[model samples]
Target: MSDARAQAPETEIVDRNLTLEIARITERAAIAAAGWRGKGDEMRADQAAVEAMHDALTRIDFKGKVVIGEMRGSEKLGLDEEVGTGRGPDIDVAVDPLEGVTGCAKDLPDALSVLAFAERGGLLHVPDAYMEKIAIGPGYPEGIVDLDKSPRENIETLAKAKGVPITEIVACVLDRPRHASLLAELREIGVAVKLLPDGDIAAVIHAANSDDTGIDIYMGSGGAPEGVLAAVAMRCIGGQMQGRLILDTAAKREQAERIGIPDLKAKYSAEDMAHGDVLFAATGVTKGSLLNGVKILPRKIVTSSVVMRSWSKTTRWITAEHQR
Candidate 1:
């Protein structure tokens, strides 16, 4: 099929404007983060990106609000103050100023600055708990597998259903101590496993767009903020994703209850979490698995990103040029 015919029709132009603004924010954050690469100061790098984004957001004339954001308390010294409230189009904001802090510190690939915008009360305000997640590229049947199954079993099932070998399926998981057993199981099953230090948003996007990236699935627990951001991108790309909250402690469970997450174990689909119109964008800060790090040239800097909206199933690979 022609790309145009396969693409979802663009319905709302307003989202395009929002996307442009978000792209600008991410671009600026990427530039600001470039200076902190290899400094062994992840917090400083993230703060610089956050400050740049805060400044860029203030310039935009949207009365949007933030439903999910970084923690604000004594722990953060120079974090941006909350500027959004429950007003205007009832929007929700999810941002990761620098998605891959360690990757940026090591100058690895796939260190991205990410953001997701949805209509008010759209994206789920999930707690900071582990989530058993399963995601695939677009046009796959829903409910093909569940997180309860063994990693090998799920891989075999998906391979049989998709009529491909288990070796062809690329699964991404964070390179953490918790993933050691899971990685071994995937290796035993002949599936290619991509271990990333951070930035599951890029991994999720890779799974949601199989035509460009060969990644067929993403299965693991990541940050709650990243789950929401990934859902926004999957919503735009017509992919399937399901996440169930995993709370490890009573304090975290209470925190979830406080945020009104009724069932911590409830399976949340992409739409269930990020409903209504959505605009998602991410620009690379340091090179990792999905994208390259921002490059500085004599005249300008170049960055790559993937932007999408629910109204359009096609994902745009944008290369932005910024003046030095």
Candidate 2:
């Protein structure tokens, strides 16, 4: 009799292996970045994370390309930098080695090392800019919230969907002058707001896990690269997100056009940015909303991570102890 399990396709096995391997990639970056916590040198902490992540990536067994990454002018792991052992499935990699360098430097919260991978061309090739984003977690009416809707309207609609009052709905936004109007509008509607200094990716994921995070929605503009990473996480968490690029200048528009983005005002949904089977991994550099920061002990380092696969709808929280 033929063994049914043996007949499974090679790509399936590759994907499963890739999911586990990607977690380790984020883990290495997190551990390395944790070493520089509270050093008050954001550049040095970020560089450490980038170098550690790049080296770990090169050791993975696959043909991986950095489609979305740090700026090209960077000294290490810039855009289009190829990693891996130069073998296995071809994949597109989106990475943010240190999502909150300032937070890490000051020993604040919500710093992380994050990355997303998909089969070649599965991830969006978005140029680094700003993205006007709005997101909500799983289990709601289709289109309960939207990027085109007003802040007040989305809050009202979400409240109605969740059987709660508008004032009880909590929204998360970055604490910045640019979001002053956004915060004012949400507050006007009596929506509770949680403002963080940085880490939009973690904020979006929190909004997606409302039951655990107590954050019902996330809105406002953030980095385009981080937007893609958040989209991938939402895909795994069964959430919804919409983003429109904030290409305000000619140079930014030109950069988008050069990247084959003909539509300047193109709106990208979570799935649109990270379509098909995908894997998302993140490890906290500092205590955070979603995962705990790396805890360095005398004999070993403890790291917390989350690895998710959209195809399988699998999300794993890994607690690993590594000997120093």
Clashes counted in candidate 1 amount to: 6
Question: Which candidate comes out best when scored by TM-score?
Answer: 2
C-alpha lDDT of all candidate models, in order: 0.77, 0.89
| Candidate 2 ranges with C-alpha deviation above 4 Å | 1-16
lDDT of 2 by residue, 1-324 (tens): 257545745454265489889999999999999999999998878888898999999998888889988753456677888888987788889999999888999999899999889888888888779999999999998888888889998999999999999989999999889999999898888999999888899999999899998999999999999999999999988988999999999999999999998789988999889997788999999998788999999999999999987766788999999999
Alpha-carbon shift of residue 225 in model 2 (angstroms): 0.5
Q: For candidate 1, which ten residues in a row score worst on lDDT?
A: 72-81
Q: Compared with the true structure, what per-residue lDDT tens digits does model 1 show for residues 241-276?
A: 888888889998998999888887788888887997
The C-alpha RMSD of each candidate to the native structure, in angstroms, is 3.6, 2.9
Q: Stretches of candidate 1 above 4 Å error?
A: 1-16, 72-88
